[model samples]
Target: MSPGASPWVLASPDVREETAMHDHRRIGRELDLFDTDPLIGAGLPYWLPDGGAVRHALEEYIRTAERRAGYRHVYSPVLGKRELYEISGHWSHYSDDMFPPMDVGGEQVVLRPSLCPHHALIYRSRSHSYRELPLRMAELGGMYRSELSGVLGGLTRVRAIQLNDAHIFCTLDQVTDEAHAALEMIGRAYEALGIAPSRHRLSLPGPGGKYVAAPGMWERATALLTDVLDRSGLPYEAAEGEAAFYGPKIDIQVADGAGRESTLSTVQIDFHQPEQFDLHYIGADGVKHRPVMVHRSIIGSVERAVAHLIEAHGGAFPAWLAPVQVAVLPVSDAESEHAEAFARRCREQDLRAEVAEAERGSLGARIRQARLVPYQAVIGPKEAVDGEVALRLRDGRRPDPLPVGEALARIGVLVSSHSTALWDDGDGA
Candidate 1:
């Protein structure tokens, strides 16, 4: 049987159902988004063309947002020397979660588990004055970890993850304001995606020896975060012992359609790492002082974010983000030229459109297949002669036949505006 015909390919009910909606894993396969192969590795997934399209769209969106927010995006190596993690204290604290190092010419190198240490090195590469404080460096970096085989699921948990990661080097006095700004950016992202604003979680270090910072620094950082939350007018719940070994963080928890909540974004204040890395900037008094490091992930991981979007929207993506926005289906071989021409016009207008040839299937079968697409433009004898297309929305609404130019214009508006509505007709059906 084909991969799509296999029932075992679908995720368990617990993995993706809230009502009768489709499972993300099933939709992923049906839509040709991504797939896993046991021969390569258990947790690794290869993204198909459709999946790659969605990811590209998402990455562009976030990169634009970060640029507007004054972040300087950069690229770094995926693997680093063992001594690099040792300087960042990850070797001592997070060694269990990291992949074992490989020997290379008498040196040990490992895949980076996080982008923090590399970012620290970037900050320390140049001397900075007080005026250059709050340097925001961002990267959509790939990381590898030794995840348990049993815990790996589609996109949510994996051994190899791509992080939407960044670090900010700022003075101590700028902590509260920077945290507040991070929260505001997260709010804007969730709002754009049409996801409900998730509740805030202020995670603090517990009495366990897992925490690495001095007791005094932990208290100050935790108190500063609490103040930031209070001043931002955002309600939050504080949790003890949930903080990372190096810092206290605020986690944004979002729920999927199945009511399963996961941390999708975070802002952390780290006093320990800067001290360990000896990151410094010249103060106004002509003295050197340690810079406070702020770690943040607006959407966390690209893979996980795409998975959440798949489940949250049931794969009916917004017009701007849809892999294939419109399918042009010709009723018969006679209309195939008209259909192809119409598709070409739509593509020229910057719309994602494709022509479904009539040679492979009947009109009815073609329509059934096009149902997976957001919009279908049918060109029959009447439509071909009249220079119009019968627009059939996936939501089952059949609007009146529209002129080819008019239909393309309207779709261009919707795509440019990123409207969530299937149609911009007065009724918004």
Candidate 2:
């Protein structure tokens, strides 16, 4: 075997079968990630303990990265008066995707379909000088949309979702640079998670889409973004009709096991919303000027990203992201005390580890159970007596043999750093 071929290698057919698009629903359950309840309605998911843990970790991870990139967290209400969408041109273009308004106090109120309209309202609620040009407002806001039942699948398609959504408001001149920074930050996020950047396509769309208020402005915006992607050495493809009604976008596409591409993220440029909302900032000359807006979602939707991660990792997540990172098994009653101590140490380090007491069944059976849950570390007397623990990998059967302290330390570092060593195929193998 190659010195560092992933410890979790599977037969080529197994990899293909596991990643196939049709297998995601089954894998979600097998991973103990999430489930759907018919009574709760279609296109919605109920996350179990492990699934919820994964979502929380993802939120913390993205939030930290956003803050480091200078994004300010903002919260917006889940429902809004019907007028907000009108002012943002969403009513004219995307009204079909929005939940129908309900009668409340003789006024129409609808669940929010997107965060941009709210962000625009926030911008208009304040008067700004040029210094406040690039106002980066980010939110993990829950949104509701009227999606077709047939299209919903697990977390990939949902009526209700908490989106890692953000909008960047910048002057025309600052647009390119701010955009570059955001894209680079997003790329880094995927990298840390062991997601291969090359798997995605950066897509640009044409100007003729409906409700695109100004063709000239659209052309200019798309050109600027095209230049940005080129300068960054990013490869992209153009899709004629994929642009949003108000602006053009860069669609991040990924392929499933069957090799079919699906959009994973979106970065859009808009020169129209500012005009529609009458948004402005005072320029150096003290005259009012509209700030350009870029609507971006690194992972698009939390639900969708979760689905992709499940399929990509084939239910065996990395240490940092795994719900149960380690499981300890004592060889017999005599080793139970030592096993408990080991599990406690792992917990103290913020690692998710559990101790399994001496059981009635065989060791092989116990081992199978451990593998079923797929722990990152599996410890027993064999390991304890040898002063080592068996490090289980999602993709491998043979655990790493290492001293207890050393194993814990290594796994701790990996989890803490959210490391994914799998992506480091330097030889391009």
Which candidate should be chosen as best, given TM-score against the real structure? 1
Model 2 lDDT per residue over 1-429, tens place: 221222234447765665654466887787778898889889888989988988888898989888988889988899999998887777888889999999999999989988888999888898999987689999999999899988787777789988989999999988889878878877887877666543333344444435556769878888888877887788676666567787777777765665545667778888888888889999999899889998888877888787777777766666677777777777677777778888888898888877766674565666666664445455566876787776666555454577888777776777778876422223421
Model 2 residue 378 lDDT? Answer: 53
In model 2, the worst 10-residue window by lDDT is 1-10
- Candidate 1 residue lDDT tens string, 215-308: 8988988998899899989888887777999989998877665455678999999998898889999999999999999998888898888888
Cα shift from native, residue 247, model 2 (Å)? 0.4
Clashing pairs for predicted structure model 1, backbone only = none
